[model samples]
Target: MNRLTLISLQVLVAVVVLVFWHIASTTTLIGNPKTISFFFAEPLAVGKRMVQWFMEGSIWYHLGITLTEAALAFIIGSLGGVIIGFWFARKPLLAAVFDPYVKAANALPRVVLAPIFALWLGLGIWSKVALGVTLVFFIVFFNVYQGVKEVSPAVLSNARMLGMNERQLLRHVYMPSALSWMFSSLHTSVGFAVVGAVVGEYLGSAAGLGYLIHEAESVFDVTGVFAGMFVLMGFVILVDWLVTLVENRLLVWRPKTSVISNR
Candidate 1:
């Protein structure tokens, strides 16, 4: 389907869901809808709250904190992940030695780690950044590792026969070959980065959209909760778009797949 058609379908689905939600909440037909917080803020109420925030200036401050944490996490985590992945992939023995340890670290509950990070970094933006980094690192690491390992033995043999040095082979063969997989993980990392930052903030920060949502929940401000969630989603979408742009630039050598019938 075309973009327009997809957009129209999404809108229609959203509207239908909203209408059903409003009717169920406003009337007693569905039983005690007031018992749950979800029923309190219908689509219109959430939209109004979102508009109010847009009208006011508080949104920027929260948004800025969230964005900063996410960007930092994305950069630091991606860098660490790529380095570790490359190192381990090149040295299978070392990778084997650390495999269980790495799995253990990845298995640990990240939410539990948030409090420790908060203690180490303090109840500030850095705490959230650190939390987000942990969430993002493993994802990129595994993808890059797998991508590097997937390089064909025949390709390596050909490059070696052509007298390619270790450095030259890595630059021309492994790195370029892994670039697509790296970016694929990076796209997912972006979303995890946001979640880590927000959840960390919700657990204990004084600022950030997550904190706002936490505060709103404490006061039973369903509209505020929805507004914060919507804003976080918008930010994630923006970052994802930016990642796609970068991917397009870097992977310019790759051929585009035919999509529309006209092509």
Candidate 2:
């Protein structure tokens, strides 16, 4: 479909959903308004709350905190993953030695680590950053490792025949090959990074969107909870869009696939 058609469809879907939600909450289409307000919350109330928070300038501080944690986690985890992935890929013995341990760490649910991190790092933003890093690290690491391992032997042999040293080979061959995989993983890692931060904050934090949601839940303020969620969803979408731009710019040399229609 063309871009305009795609966008129109998306907007139509959103409008339909909102209308249904309003009917369900304001009218007795599904349940009483009171009951619906108690549970699902009225969309109008949620929207008003979101707007009020924005107008009062109370959201920026919480939004900034979450964004900072996510950005730090993404940067630190990705760099560490790329470096370690490259090292392990180059050293078969090292990779073999650490394989089980790496698997074990990745298998452990990150939620279980939140309280431990909170205790160690306190309720500050660093604890959330640490949690996000753990979630992002494994994603990028595995992708990079696989990318390097998947390099064609013929390509390696041809490069070596041209007298390319280890550094030159890495610069011209390995880095580029692994970068494609790294970017692919990054798209996924961005969401996980946000998840980690929000989960961490929900578990324990002085300030954050997650904290706001947790507070609303404690008081059974469903509208506030929904407002917080909508804000978070918008933030994630913005971050994902920025990541897409970076990916497109960096991977411009890669082949593009077009969808052809048969009429």
Could you say which candidate leads in lDDT? 2
Worst 10 residues of 2 by lDDT: 254-263
Cα-based lDDT at residue 106, candidate 1: 99
Backbone atom clashes (below 3 Å) for every candidate: 0, 0
Estimated TM-score for each candidate: 0.89, 0.95
lDDT of each: 0.85, 0.91
Clashing pairs in 2: none
* Candidate 1 segments exceeding 4 Å error: 1-3, 28-39, 253-263
The TM-score, computed over Cα atoms with residue i paired to residue i, of candidate 2 is 0.95
* lDDT of candidate model 1 versus the reference: 0.85
Taking the tens digit of each residue's C-alpha lDDT, what string does model 2 give over 117-194? 999999999999999999999999998999899989999999999999999999998999898888866678999999
Q: Against the correct fold, how does model 1 do in TM-score?
A: 0.89
Please identify model 2 stretches exceeding 4 Å from their true place. Answer: 258-263
